[model samples]
Target: MNFAAAVSVALNALRVNALRSFLAMLGVIIGVGSVIVMISISQGAKAAVDAQISALGANSLQLRPGSSFRGGVRGGSGSATPLSDEDVEALRETVPYVIAAAGIIQQRGLTAVVDGVNWSTEVAGTHPDYFIVRDWDIVEGRAFTVPELDGAARVAVIGRTVANELFPAGGAIGASLRISGVPLEVAGILAERGQSSWGQDQDDVIFVPATTMRNRLGGLSTAGVRNPVQSIWLGIDRARNMEAATEEITDLMRVRRNIRIGGTDDFAVVNFAEFLRARNETESQLGLLLAATAVISLVVGGIGIMNIMLVSVTERTREIGLRLAIGAKQADIRNQFLIEAVVLCVAGGLVGMACGAIGALVVESMGQFPVSIEPMIAFVAIGAAAGVGILFGFYPAHRASRLNPIDALRYE
Candidate 1:
């Protein structure tokens, strides 16, 4: 038969059993929908994380204390040895690639009260450079000035969440809020950052000058000496030089701290790029696992196609015998059955693709998750569905081809 005739015959066969055709297509629909939905969600999460990381500012390096490693495993050493004011100054003077750096000291369990309304939140002490490094903006008022930091001014910048909680009527700027019982004038109100996927409110914290936090809060003291810093955040001039800058800073810090070659460096320098890469790898693996699970449904659907094809071969024995007796070649008989199988799978795949697209859109609209459906993924899915049809339909098509004309003619 010609290609057109073969396709026409396949269409007629499917039309004769509309319910069976739909049942066969259901598996592909489920498989494609599941895979697409999982991928869309994963992509959304990755995008959210990327946005948060980028909001931390480009080429930002965080310096904290590294845990003491013992026996090839991480062992918790108490809180990281505090970075000092001297260390911060040394980095500024020595590191040419460092554009800006700010020392941070954080204190939780602090209550801020304004207008008789109190809210418990984190209070972080940082320099004016902190706003620059974090890409933070003062929506209503100015950031702390250099003079404020030097004089250890009791000025505070409240996050959006803190502002709303403490001053529900929205006029928090220029007000005074006592943090940990220390009166601090509200210097500014930060813009809203929204909640993280981990359910943490990114805008619930407060910012203060590092010096004021160290002196007034009194949380930095340890073992008879006041450890004045919790971390130093650095923003690099060039993103491409982050790795080289990180290594140079680490060496500079070690030499300044007087740690010998054999002695472990007491501090940790973190590269945000490394963290982003690790997170992407984990998400990629999860996507693979979910896609595999979804593909199993396609396989199950393929099996259903095979079963139905077998029944079709048996029921059409008389038709096959009549065609063979009239001048049909073995190749013609095989091609007919193969076309029917392919038609079933391809139809099912087309339906599945539409359903998957709709499913992704619905999920995105309903859950507020970003949905990205790459064209290549759709192509791959269609190809996969066609492959399943051929692989599973092979045996039944061959059996139909091998039926003896005389035996098939007498069967009915």
Candidate 2:
């Protein structure tokens, strides 16, 4: 028989045992579907992590004071010692790579009252240049003026979450909001920045001038340190400048704070570049592990296909004998069986592709994690499924081809 006729015959044979054929292909369907879903979701996670890491800006650094060793009971960075405005100035003067720096003071449990609607949130006090250090954009109105930041103006910039909660009806810009009984003008509304990598909400706070927070809200005091602010933020001129800037800033903080050499640092300077690299590496490793799991499933699916094809050969002994008796060559029988196996796998692959797409969509709608479909992934899955069929189906096809015509005919 010709190639087309052999394919037609093989298809008819599958059609005759429709239930068995469907059962045989089930493994391939599951294997391909799982692989596609796993790959797409892993890739999406990697992309999301990278994007979020970049949100912090590659050249940014956060400086926080170290422990104070008060009464032999030491607490961590935030309350140990307070960073001052002088530190910010010294960083600018001493470090050439440090372009801009700002002092930040945080006050939590501040109640913001707007038209009798009160919401409790944390407040941040920083210079006007803090926005530049953070690479933040003011979506409405404008950023604080130098006069506002320097002279303790009662103007505040609110984050997206704060605005949405305080002014559900919209129009947050230029609104008057009272914070802890102190009325402050809303100078700007920040754009939405959903969440941090550590799952903290980024848009749930307010930004006021450092002077305003100190004077109006009362300066934050620490156990051992006389005056304290939460942390200092700095922006380097370039990504490559982080290492040198960190060293210089550390040295300056050491000398300024009177920290002795061979002793622990009195302050912490955190460079975000190292964090970015570590995050990317983590994502890549996670993707590789998931990909390995997917490959293992495919291998198991291939084994299932082999088992079913072998059973098929045993059940079709008389049919093979009859074909051989009709002057059909061994190669023709082999080709016919191989075609049948390939068709089954290809059909399973198609169905699996559809299942994978549906799974991805369902997962995405749940909003728990990121999932993005890459079309090329589906094609690769289908090709692998086809390869599975060819590899697993060969042995069964060979056995059928080598069968003795006389013995096959006499079998039950």
Candidate 3:
């Protein structure tokens, strides 16, 4: 039989048992839908993470006290000891690739008061270079001057959140606010930087001079050393050189800290690029698992189609025998069944694609997750559906083709 005639026969068969064909296609619908939804969610999560990381600035590397991978505590050994002004200066003078570095000391429970309104916030003690490294912009007034950092002046910059909390009607700059009971003048108000994906408010802190934090707020202590600096922030000339610069800094610190060759370095260095890559890998793995689960449903659906097709062959035995008597070849009978199976799957796939799109939109609306339906994903799903039909339809088609013409004609 020709392609058109085979398709017509397949369509007529499915039309005679509309409900059964629909049922057979149900599994494909579910499988395709699940894959699309899972992939969309994963992509959304990755996008959010990437956005947060990008907000941290490009070519940035964070040097914290402990090893990020192994250290249980942030301030523990095997992490770098509290970064200091001396370390910052050494990096500036010695490392040509290093563009800027800032020592940071973080102190929570710092209270900011303006008039009667009071807000407790985290205060980061850092130098003027921190602004450059962090890519933070001042909306009002200016960052603390070099002279102020050198003199350990009690000056502070308030984040947008802190500014709003302290001075709700604006005009908080040049105002004096007490940090840990010590008075400091608010020199600048940072522009709004929204909340992070982890739900932490990024703009709810205060910035101060590193010197003032050490002198007044005291230093962070771990195992009783009173380590002053919590971490160091560095910006390199190029992001591509982040790894090389990180290694160079580690070597320099190891020598400066007198760490033996066999001993593990106490400080931890983190690159955002590494973090992003690891996150992407994790997302991809999860996506594959979800897609596999959906594919399993498709296989089950295919089995259903096969079962129905076998029954169909048995029910239409007499018709097959009559067609064979009227010059229909075994090949023609086989093609008819095959086309019917393919039609069932293709139709189901189209319907499944539509359902998947609607489902994605619903998820996006309800969960507020960004859902992206790539055209490639849709095409893959459609192709898989068709493949399932062919794979499952083959056995039944072969069985029908091999049936004895004499027995089929004699069936009651």
lDDT of 3 by residue, 346-368 (tens): 88888888888788889888977
**Candidate 2 global TM-score:** 0.84
lDDT (CA) for every model shown?
0.81, 0.84, 0.81
lDDT by residue for model 1 (243-265), tens: 88999999998897667899787
State the lDDT at 163 in candidate 3: 86
Ranking by TM-score: 2, 1, 3
Candidate 2 clashes between residue pairs 3 or more apart in a chain or in different chains: none
Best by the lDDT measure:
2
- Per-residue lDDT tens digits of candidate 2, residues 89-176? 7787888887778888887788999999989998988888788888888999888887887789999999999998999998888899
How far is 201's C-alpha from truth in model 2 (Å)? Answer: 2.9
Please say which candidate is ahead in TM-score: 1 or 2.
2
Can you give the lDDT of residue 388 in candidate 2?
88
TM values, all candidates: 0.78, 0.84, 0.76
